[model samples]
Target: MTTEHIDDSAWISDKDSPVVARLSQLISALTNLTMETTEDLQVANYGVGGHYSPHFDFYHVTIQFIRRSCQIFCFRSGNRIATWLTYLSDVELGGATVFPMVDGYIVPKKGSAAFWYNLYASGEGMIFLRFIALN
Candidate 1:
């Protein structure tokens, strides 16, 4: 996995910021899922040559079993069901989200968002829905 820098302070609570609250509401509305089931917003900053390797968002059976005793918060909520990614800034070059299985490529554009289901209705991870950062 490639290293990425995340602004930990960016996990703004809805009560702390009206913008965050509105965004959360919008996401809940778009996904038809309650905000209670969603995780806090994450902001990752990538510099030149930064990238993320392909991976699934949902937890696998083995992972769930291993983390069950240690992660109470995760178990209480559930595995990730969906992903809603919003690009904050435009990249001049080599910053694309690629899904190899579907031949999908999304260029990073400011204010653009991408949404996808990480699991099926039956709660199985969608193995084909993996993304890698090409930068």
Candidate 2:
């Protein structure tokens, strides 16, 4: 799987498209919170036969923390943000991102989206955004 890091200052410059602009607005409205407005957006593309296997978002590797771990850190650092997955297209058969632990699942809807928290005040982190892609 591929991931990208968003900064608090680059969200506007990077998400200048009309659709993304609307999405950013929606995210702000839904959370009743403000973002640092950076751009470290991750754009992972899986083709017809490609898929991301199940995995936890954060983990401490031998070298350091992983990418998703940074996502957790950013949230804990006071972002008060949530993740919204806006699907660009719909597939007939596969590629749904699922969170088994939360008993929640997101089916991609073209031009629409899905959302969930990467961290919680109760101290749960990365359990809900576990990337489980279907084959």
Candidate 3:
């Protein structure tokens, strides 16, 4: 996976990027949440040595987000929410995105995407969102 940090306000630009832009818009539409609430929606490309360790999406509560979220409650209650993950490219092997629960696994399809949501809440009654690419 290739990782690069950017300023919080950096705009993403790339050819054939409309799918991701649409996905982001859909995310905003699906929930009352806003991306601005978080520092930034950092984007990365994963291929080799790119697996993400199991972790929570949000580090802590923020006044900009809801105190509790359907995401958390659904996860803890054994329910599932819809999340959208778009792949920028294809890999030969070992790059599926995996979640510890329900054996969540999605293969990379260039310009395609997957959707799922977390159902667990945080200690402070907050919601979390996270994902990783296995490479």
Candidate 2, lDDT over the whole model: 0.59
| lDDT sort, best first | 1, 2, 3
Clash pairs, model 2 backbone? 5-40, 6-40, 7-38, 8-37, 8-38, 9-38, 10-38, 10-39, 11-38, 11-39
lDDT of 1: 0.77
Model 2 earns a TM-score of: 0.61
lDDT value for model 3: 0.52
Please give the CA lDDT of all the candidate structures: 0.77, 0.59, 0.52
- Highest TM-score against the true fold, candidate: 1
lDDT tens readout by residue for model 3, 10-116: 33532337754565667777675554432223466544565556544433334234436644643454333334566778888677776655456688878886654
Better of 1 and 3 by TM-score: 1
lDDT of 2 by residue, 28-111 (tens): 788775645534455666666666666654432432345785767656654423566667788788767877877877888788
lDDT of 1 by residue, 1-135 (tens): 215322223566787789888999998888898888666787777667777777667778664355554366557767888988888899997888899999998998999999999989999889888778766
The Cα error of candidate 2 at residue 91, in Å, is 0.6
Runs in model 3 deviating more than 4 A are 1-23, 30-39, 60-83, 119-132
